[model samples]
Target chain A: MTASSDIDALAAMILARELESALSKRADCGFQLLSSGQEAVAVGVAAALLAHDQLLCSGRSIAPALARGLDPGRVMAELIGRASGPCLGRGGRGHLSQPSAGFFGAHAVVAGNLSIAAGVALALQARRDRSIAVCMFGDGACGAGALHETMNIAALWQLPLLLVCDNNLYSVSTPRAAALAPQRLSDLAAPFGIEACTVDGMDVRVVREAAVELTDYVRNGGGPAFLECISRRYASHSTSARETRGQQELAADRELDPITRLENALLSEGALSAQTAQALREQVRAKVAAACAFADLSPLPVPEEAFADVV
Target chain B: MSSEPVRTRRVFFREAICRAVGETLDAEPNAIVMGQDVGAFGGSYKEFYGLFERFGPARVRDTPVAEAAMVGLGVGAAAAGLRTLVSITYMDFVLLALDPLVNYAAKARFKTGGQIRVPMVVKLTAGAKGQGVAHSQSLESWLMSVPGLRVVAPSNVADAYGLMRSALQADGPVVYVDHKRLFPTSGPLNASAHEVPFGLAAVSRPGRHATIVTHSYMVCVALAACDELAVSGIDCEVIDLRSLAPLDLATVCTSVSKTGALLTLEEGQVVCGIGAEIAYQAQARLGPVRVSRLGAMPAPVSSNPVLEAASLPDAGRVADAVRRLLMEG
Candidate 1:
């Protein structure tokens, strides 16, 4: 593995961990959403894309924002509903977007943003730009009719779009087995003749490798591609949920935590020493602390600006 | 009509709309047209029959039979800097795509604090034409209720051409509704480039006794009713509200104040429709004085033409509505 890839993976884990922890504390701030075990998938997708390429994400995927290099302080501010945030506090935590960073907001609606990403790709194709459009959605979004419609058009038009399905098993409280049929979500692409693959989402290196390969294929004139990452959620679906799934399931998923998996792999491969990993974790914790301070100092949006932007 | 060069050779309403779309696509490179059969097979109404042959598939795209995804794609494309025109084919089918149209496209700019703009036009065909319960309904009022959506309906051929250009040029999203019944109706087409701005009502006919407010195909019925009322000395002033969202209430108020009476005609349902809003606003502005509304009955329009006609307001029904309003005094 390249030195840059190792550092990027470590940094991504730290940022996701910090955001999850901080957001966990603010339980009273409406609903609590987290992308805990799906960090590797989001980070991998983000790392695969070029800087100019755009990312359309779902509300649960904050790792994409951090991986795209958005300011952690600004991310926190947006989450806490601060005026200094990317959306001026109008989007709150779920609908955060930084256009300059190529992170085009996290849509609260499932599969809705996925279709929009296809449009973004169409726009890029219209302009003859080499840049591609990447969209990240959960396993539940895979069953939507909108996704099927989008896949048809994306393949028929040969659009430059990469669809990443973060299959972390449950969508709110429903299990994938009960909701989706035919088991493999990647089969959704087969009817459209688009190339697809499934990867172990807990393995950051493997996810990144798949993302990079698929993104390259899409960036070229190879049309749209799909990458399904088999992930697991260590935490509950939301921050407020008291039930922590089944004990056996939780314990099994916890053992496959992407962050721990990456750290162990790095240490064993001599890519990162145990001491260095410890230092990196401490450094990220302190940085997140500073971001929390910045978020605290951020102001609320003035009431008078409420009616602005209606047009 | 008159020997005017500005009016194109008495072409049908569909031809006028096609001309306008062709002209806009010719002028703007970033503008794209997409719908279910907009490409390859042309449009459902033949509004874009020859566009694909002229502009190729790059600009004219044929999407899957997915209304929600189609609208979502338009919203995304518009925000990404391309002016998009997405067609819903039938207005009744817009129900399947309401989530994206009402939630995503309408709230995108506002929720993003104006950092993004969605300059898109959704071309929908409405009004009853024996297409059946699921296909034949007028839902312009539903779109009118949306905050960020601009709802415009053109009753005549000239307005159709002019309003489409204005919709494409507007800074925000526009829901341009066209009546399916008006597809074959031919009228004097103005060849000159013109634009009908939003929030302005067109006085299709002038009178002094009562003000008849309506839009879309109902404008024709309202005009016919005006002629009948003229014989009875009611002299109804027919005002066609071109844009519903940026409603031209000032014009309606001016006419209401002059006429001292108001009557609203619409093809949509009588309950909570555009006519109801006009009556409410008229009462609010000028204190209710013989105000009455005529619209389709509160039921699904049937596949049978006779049943559809009975449900919808016609010239005779509009005239009767006006007569009832006058008789109340």
Candidate 2:
């Protein structure tokens, strides 16, 4: 294999390793809002990304951000408000930033990144380069007008934009059925004349296949594409959601864990043994311990840092 | 319309605007123009006349009556490296395009940590004299409240040329407010290469007693008032606030600080307007003085010529404000 390919594969592994460690470890520490169900969507997207592609994510993007090579220690550090975090601790967890990985910081405002995603896509077109923009918003975000406006514009201009909606059923406590009008999220882009696709959020391989096709389609001049991954968030909204929702819905979502599906699939294929999966879990635990230690030891930002990085 | 000669230089405001559109296209291969009546009709106000001949249908484009969609398309075009000029005929029509202009075009570049530049200039006409409330609104104040927008209102030929060039070349969105009345107003010529830097006030007339600060066609009224003020022994300096956003507060403040007196003139409503912003800053910077302002009264402008005259601040009101400041001093 080529040196670049080798590096790409290795980086993907490290990112996944770091993410697994960060997610499992920080889940308990950072309000226990773990997204164990959306792992497939995240892994699929992260796998399909070109190194130069920019990933502008919205909140509830734990899996995608981690999958995109966000450092384990930095994710943990950000969660714990440490100096070494992606945003230097100013933006912890949901507001993470990893510029080197091409992961622009996550936005808290729902669907606000729609136009921003178009802007980045436009930037890619302006440079006369081949890089595409990957934006992940929830089904809740599709309801926002900015999303519709951006989709139409992106499609009209044939912009290199890969808009992915990780429909985790609920925005926070409100289900997609409650917040969004159309039952299916991909319906949002149909009127915009953009190509639309859907995938089982529980299957990373399926999602990976879809992403590759869509990315290539857009790269070959197909206009912006929207892919809706009907995923589930197997954890609380944040450290705060567990207290906010009743026990029944959260319990229902737990039954659809993508991590378990991947693990089971690996076992069936003999790529992984039961002992191997257990060992991987143990490794994740150990890595989390090290990252948490690093985060805890990190320093607070100086007073001058406040005025810096205002945007 | 008066039987005025085709003072080509005075009429350069519309020419400069259309020329900038065509020139920008010639300068940058990616430049395009899209709006109602732009392509075939040559624009609703004839500002975009002959653009189709210069750049063809692809670049000199026409868009549907979707104001919000048009702004969104402009944003996309800008992001895609096309210096797109999206002209919404009336400043009042901006109400339809506000969401896109306010939320997307304005903040997209900054919010992305400089990932993109919406180098899109929205050309709009305000201050229509005889056109009723719907058409004559100087909504520059309404649009100025949006952050990340460099709002500009040029009063004369030089500004018309300069501001359009600056807006066309900017890395962010600019709302270039063209006054309906000042379209024919003339000033010093700017030849072929004309550019107006943003956030700098244009001093039409210099004085020491006090400064009459205004923008757009009102600059002419302010100058006329300055002339009247000079007759009455008031050395009134008229400072034209060309670019409204990155406001040249320093210029206004320096003029106010030097002459301990100030008066503001606008064509919009008097309350909670841009004039209020200037008054607040001037009061804090250059102690509370007898500051006066002339603008449209709270009531909307009527079709009656006399009422229309009273609706918007005239040269007499500007001179009266200057006189009030001088008397209080």
Candidate 3:
């Protein structure tokens, strides 16, 4: 397929799979994995990334890692705690890691991934290689010292790193207005003199287009770019976590349900047929089911080897 | 175990640091030093003097005063197959670089499910002696708290060279600490550029009377204490622990298991210091034995030489601890 067609296909695959899992005719439809309505944000930015590009995903942006080449099967297993999971059933849903796939785990510690991504990107820079390191964090990470330190260093050295912030309006129950001093998360990069951009996270293309520009800028020694993709979360913070969190999901979901938006766009443009979308939905469901089955059939980890990887 | 007579040597603490680093670069082609002013301007401590001229600018890189960035770059360079020795002037300065050292470099191997290996050495000047409270601080205890980090503090001239060599060759991130006080003090090296394995213990002196467990500069103090104790019929076996993370407990325990008495010395505060860990380890091996810790008494270090001496362990105190332990035994 052509490059344009390829991007479209990738977008379609992301929307279809995520929609089937998050909102579909399946029995487990409306089963929320991520709390934020940021599926489009992941699909968009992930489409712009090269397969070899590394990702240090923070506590937010769960869908991005999977889109960026992490085996969806492994992630599905990881979310439910299965032997075949990428994290070996060690890390729960929020902490899945697949280093081989360049998907570093989601760290709860705010702005923790910035330094990690910067370091990895700096390593790539020293080698003079053309590989981008993507760090997807939330608004909370902007306030962290690690982010500022990393951004300053990254900018000074002109490291190839993409620091994307999923400004999901709130950190759990607290609104962004209550936590961050600045209204826009991208503005936090101004002090470090790093390039910053704000995007419409509801439309995945906006994120993808911005990601393309940012990726080029990063590789060309424009330094780290802070892209604030303002989106909202649909689910509660955790499993059945109902305490009236910030960023009303139903309204945001209506305006920015990535799967629905993508489907409408592709259908209207004659790029994707409704029949094709339906087929893709079924295929994703089947794939997830097969993954669940594989996880069930897999053997339990050796009890003695519980602390195998830990120092 | 070098029988060769000591050759004439004179390099000031700063000069020796540069000379030693230059020597390391001379020895290994893959080895490079990178930090702020490490290239053209030499370094804050002049530890990387003349390196820019001989090794070229790329090998002796000058990074911005961003410790996190510099440390992260070191980790990256190490993983990309370069033996990088990144230095921050003081141990306290490592606070800025703790993220890379703690999160990325140290936990990379374990967190990645043992896929990647970080082989980098961080040369940090530890301990204080009028370098001011900010510059003169020991963060070895902080480093020890981190898992997957090999903490090495070479008390004197020989171990400084040996520790740097070993840490460069190590499979993981190694924190090579050097005290400001012991950098100038000349001592016999077993062999210049020899690999002093990370977990090996140095028997500074062999004696059967009492086992004095100490490391870094304190090893010299313990050795001198043995001389003083000789007059008082108390001979102390001073074991200089070179490595901290994978502490050479076998060597210290063997010494303590034999002498049946242990004493720990630290240049930092007395509470929750390296001595406490050594005491716990020694006691665990050789059933309950009274251990003496020689260090500062919870207060900030005094600027006065005499007051500093009081806070720091000296030969006199080490000898007294030995005599008292013997009396009790």
Candidate 4:
């Protein structure tokens, strides 16, 4: 279990990095970023969740999809708005979702899917299905009204909802201190009677441990739980964002990069050798290149197709 | 007119909705009813009374006063294969949930290449009563303008029952608007297995002089105006448009062609109202000889009865518009 999880986590981090690199090199066509810095949390949460469990992701949280085992090629296709994309190019990178992959949909609105997660949780409970509904949003989403409403109802109904706030500290350009008053994002959950805690999002193992604990608690009728995973954004809000952040802050955040930390831990534990890690990196790079080529070769949707799915 | 014995019953507008929802809940195991005060409290308007007891909390659940979340919940739940019926207590509150309804639910399937289907029904009460602007405005035109959304505004109890059933059984998302004034008004209802498909106009009263096209509570206002015009030997036809989106322009154009005149009455604002589309269609379809549209003024509905009446399109306004259309001819 440990070996597979370690490999899976490493694979997710590599794919995310490759996706970021590929997207940055491509022309500003409308592709967004949900890569790097936050890969550990996405991979960690995806690792802990069951295959059938539903995931409602934020617009920028693409790493979860990679960890959930979605085809990187199809994801790239979706990002480019090709017909082969998950949403058939109807929704671009911001709205990547394939429910068969247990990814319900990635909402572009910050906290938009919170209520959706609550509703899905309600439906799961009604069906008497032991499977749970999980959602991940940024720290910026904590201030949205949907979050409070959803939390209140999830706790009130005792719905099996696991809300993970990937506290990347910055909501686009605004700092967490400027937006949120509470020191810890999970502290706000206390008023709703939701059991919440802050976890080290930089460590994949730590995130996995926290996710597994909370996931089990919710599945075992422990109701809703909120986990605030503290992380940082390696890139700007989007691929097109030109406003350079403070160099000092960026350097500070880069110091705790989850990918590097995971690599060292795995190397120290003798789970992965330097040569093997290099080979894995090459494999991921090749996969990313193939995915990009696949997306680039995919055809654009025909004009008539727009009128087909409105019903 | 069929050989089979027809079953008919008299029921209140609210009762028709309840019966339709109750029947849908009983039939579909995955069907659920949710919204603010929709469960044990029997809905804010008592439209869902006793449903919680019959269906249990799992099926008949009450939601918080979070309109955005409530509609979003319906979207997510519906996407998860549950046929959900979510009610917005007032049409005005739908503004809070426009993101999910318009951006999410309405466009979900289209974006997903028909891979994801959001089979949910959003039922909200619209129209002017004494509730003022926050609760009285008829925003069906706003929903009607959105593609990928089936907008239905039933005028009578029978259409309400039939349309509700159709909405529940629909393959995609539907926004069903019920006027606040029509709730207490009793009408003949047929609680059968039949469904009222979209884009069909029901001619309530047939006449040769002119045609009055309308829907929801305005249908009753048009009928009343038709009676007033009939007294002067100027018989007018009343076309009640049950569904707005897939607009039954065939029935409307047919009536307009026969009458050679058209008048549209609506409780919504005049700017970009449903009447505008009908007027444009009238010009393009039949090359209109005489046409007029009566809609609420471009202003909020006031709490004062007199001001509200003056701001809205009622029987008197419809009669006046019809008179002007006939006079112009």
Candidate 5:
């Protein structure tokens, strides 16, 4: 149980925030779904995963990919459609993947990766390797039939899968209450006899604790488990989508920002000094700049690349 | 020294499929089968008979009635290092699973830049046998248009065995479509293992007047029409298009060049159908050959015997279409 320290969590959050800021300034970043306010959930779940375990997520993958230990330069290159990326710029924005790094990849569809994660778990179980598959999706995916179907099958077959829902409470303008009838998103797993829990997503420690517990149960052949992290999204649904919330509401949401809260908590406890936090910010900014520089130097894929690897 | 004569045995279409899958399970340690009623029930068409008993529960799995999850599980497993075959009892039910099939399995290799390959087969049973509108459909044309999919249909027992073997060995996603009408029929199959490569059309019958191009059960219909037309001093050539995606236009052009007339027959619709593509491409290659197409009426197929017959093309309709094509040319 080598858990990530509080300082490490703060560094990961700062890196995600810096990456999101850098990506926003680029004109060629295309349609990105930034995980600006939801970094805690991504870092928390990634902290509990082993080297052999696989992690899958929805289109909002910048934070998750970075937290899962992928090379920052290659992830930047992939998002900007460069030939040097893991996917060679073929799976540009909504589909960035590098399975060798244990990040199985990101699929743009809402509930699309749920069953896929179960299948990966099935393969892992077959090998008897004790490695689990984790899928991170949004609140919008909870209403889909794919989730229910995957849950039923995963429970029936005892697949080692961890279903994490990063519930930001909005699906491009539709509130979670208006879209789903469940009192708690994790309650949906109850019907399938899956052990489930809800936690404060804005608190990195809380999210990490829940994730480690659930993943432990799954890795021990306890079948699939569900963990719902109630978080907030600071950005719009995507780069092309419009912001539907009011200014006051946005300000209130920002007050609960995971990065600021973690930094403030660490500062109050004297675990991190003001000068040290400022220096850490400068370090992350430099790292992000280096990643951007590497991506800029890489060339775009050739037009003929569209015909390659297509059976 | 002369080699011993090659031994062959006659087997039903269902038995041919069972042998191919059973052999694959025996050879490949990672291959598994998943679908509804595929375990103890031995598949709805009995095409998977003896597979569950032979492979047991771990390899031969019976899934709940969830098509989306079934396909997603297969695609995910394949991408993660397991080869899988998902059986959709009826082709119509495949619509529920297309999101995973078309979006995930089809584009996996290309999207991952060859980092991952999904060597999975989605076996679908097509055609009408009084099953009504939703259960009866020949949707091969819809799958053919997808960029990274390999669509194969087998009309006889040997092809059923050979094509399945090839599909199991393919590097990416392959849609294996079998017809309801072909299961009862039996044909000779070679004793040794064999594979029918994709993108090749077989010339079933040779003639000089006109050429009939079809696949699956429609090949039988086209052959019967050829027999009837021969009595009236008409000789028709029939070509079976085994693989629809990488269509073998060379074989079709060769047959059309000699006959100078062509009629495309299919059990599916004509608008944006297999015949339309075949006829257009054949004419483009050979330059100005007579062309006609015969297919099901543009209406929903019903369970009623008369309605089902009226909605689909029969031997008489194919014979008339061939006659009209030759007379007009």
Candidate 6:
């Protein structure tokens, strides 16, 4: 991968890690779904998108939102329910969105955003602006009827949409193998006539290459395409949920950490010195600290705000 | 010089809807219609008869029989800068698509801090027509309680056209309910462009003895009851509640104040139905007044003609309720 791409991916991973650390300590952070080990999927897919293209994701949105160029401070403000957030603190973490910045936002419902993303693609197609819509969902969403329905219509209409499945192998405590019957998640798109592929989601380089090729096909009017990124989640589903995996499995999963893998790869190639990696970490730490400070200074919305913007 | 006399053309309820939607498509370049049979088949009730031919396949598109995806796509497209009107063939089927309509479209603007607005209309055909339990329902009351949803029902051609026009132009999500039975009916339509504003009730027939407030096909039932009651030397006012969410309680209370009696009528269930809401609100505003609510029997609507007739409220039932309410002193 190019040096700039590698730096962007590393910065996103660091931001997610720092955000998770900061959010876990706050008492008023509310319920959060963190992307602890799945940073590569978000950053890599976001790298392939143009400024005009819109990206949508599931409830685990901190990584996707940050990777799609949302301000770290504003995201923090929204997460902490501050008035300065993009949604004026109304959306919180699950519904965080900034459509003007091409992040169509996240929907908490599983598989809920699939059809919505197709609709966004339909609108973009109507404009003839060649802007595509990409939706990132979990392996759990593959079992839903909405995904099938969306795929059928999307394929029939040839909407400019890219379906990215961030397969983290578990839905809460349930392992994907125990819950889903699919031999390979990418095979779900075969019947819909959509081009499909599976890749190593732990490596940002592999994820970005696959995303670029798939997005190119979609942008060139090749209809919809599906990419299954086999990744791992280092944390439980939500901050409040109990961990189902044992200590040994957790330790094994950490060995495949996307950040460590990339850092090691760059270090071996002499592309990133130990000094430079330390400097990047310090820079990311300061940025995250400033973001937290901004959120700490931001005020919460007044009680009357509950009734605002309601029709 | 003599001026030409103004003339108004009459049209079927479905044609009025067609004209209103056609006008919207003509005026707004981004407006589109999506639903089962909305394209070449011209909608289940032919409400979208000529839209496909006029707008072409691009704007007037037919979707699969998947109600969830249809509504979700419409909501998503609306939020992404396109005005869409999704048609669900039956109100009963709207349950399948409520996740998107109620959860996403209804809350998009409020949840997004007004940064995103879903300017879409979900047109559902409601009421019983011997279509059986699963296919027949009047679920407008269920949607009325949602905070950001605008619920409107049209009893005649004018309001059908007018409510749809307003719903399409509104900057939020609207549930535009049209009755299946009303599709065959016709009424006079003014040639010039006009729109009926929301939250306004039309006094279909004015009287001094009692007020019968209803909407959709029940408006016709109420008017028929008024006709029956008029012969008995009882003058009853008929108020058509065109919009259910932003209910025009002021007009209802005004009539209740003058008549000293109110009868809330609807074709849906009486328990927690439209009448229950209207009755409570009207009495809350006008103090204690003799009131009665008439609605469907507490049983499932059947396709059997006899059972269907026994399940829903009729003019006779409405008249009897009004009589009972008036006799209460």
Best by DockQ: 6
B216-327 per-residue lDDT for model 6 (tens digits): 9999989898899999999999999999989999999999999999999888888898889998998888889998988889999999999999999899988999999989
Off by over 4 Å in 5: A1-4, B1-6
Q: For the second chain of model 6, what is the TM-score against the true structure's chain B?
A: 0.98
TM-score of each: 0.97, 0.81, 0.88, 0.97, 0.98, 0.98
Residue A85 of model 4 has an lDDT of: 85
Worst 10 residues of 3 chain B by lDDT: B7-16
Model 4 docking grade? medium
Q: List the residue pairs that clash in candidate 6.
A: none
Q: After superposing candidate 1, which stretches have Cα over 4 Å from the reference?
A: A241-244, B1-9
- 3 or 5, greater by TM-score: 5
Superposed Cα RMSD, model 3: 3.8
The collision pairs in model 5 are: none
Return the interface RMSD of the candidates, in order shown, one decimal each.
1.0, 5.1, 3.1, 1.3, 0.6, 0.6
B1-329 in candidate 3: lDDT tens per residue? Answer: 54665653544555545656777778777777877777778887666778899999668877777787678668755754567889887788899888778876776665444556777889888776775657766768778878788999887666676677677678889898888777667655543446677889888889887888877777777888888888867767888898888789999988988888888887777677888899998888778986777775566666676766666667887787777767787
lDDT for B226 (candidate 1): 83
Q: DockQ score for model 6, please?
A: 0.87
lDDT (Cα, tens digit) per residue for candidate 1, span B258-310: 98888988988878889889989988988867898888898889998888887
lDDT of 2 by residue, A192-282 (tens): 8888888897677678788888888877778799989988765556656643556786677666555656666667867667886676666
- Candidate 1 per-residue lDDT, tens place, A218-281, comes to 9888999999999987677776666548898888888998898888878898888888888888
lDDT agreement with native, every candidate:
0.86, 0.74, 0.72, 0.87, 0.93, 0.93
lDDT of 3 by residue, A1-311 (tens): 24465445445445435533542233432233463457767777777777567777775545765666666666555555556666665554455667567665565456666766776676666566788788888877767667776787777767788998988776767788988898688888898888888998877777888988999888777888889998876666654457484355566466766667767877788777788877766776676676556655765556754566544
Candidate 4 per-residue lDDT over residues B23-83, each given as its tens digit? 9889999999889888889987788988999999888888878898888888888988899
lDDT, model 5, position A109: 93
lDDT leader: 5
- Candidate 2: stretches off by over 4 Å: A1-36, A70-105, A122-131, A236-245, A282-311, B1-11, B29-42, B48-87, B92-124, B128-149, B186-188, B192-194, B227-235, B299-310
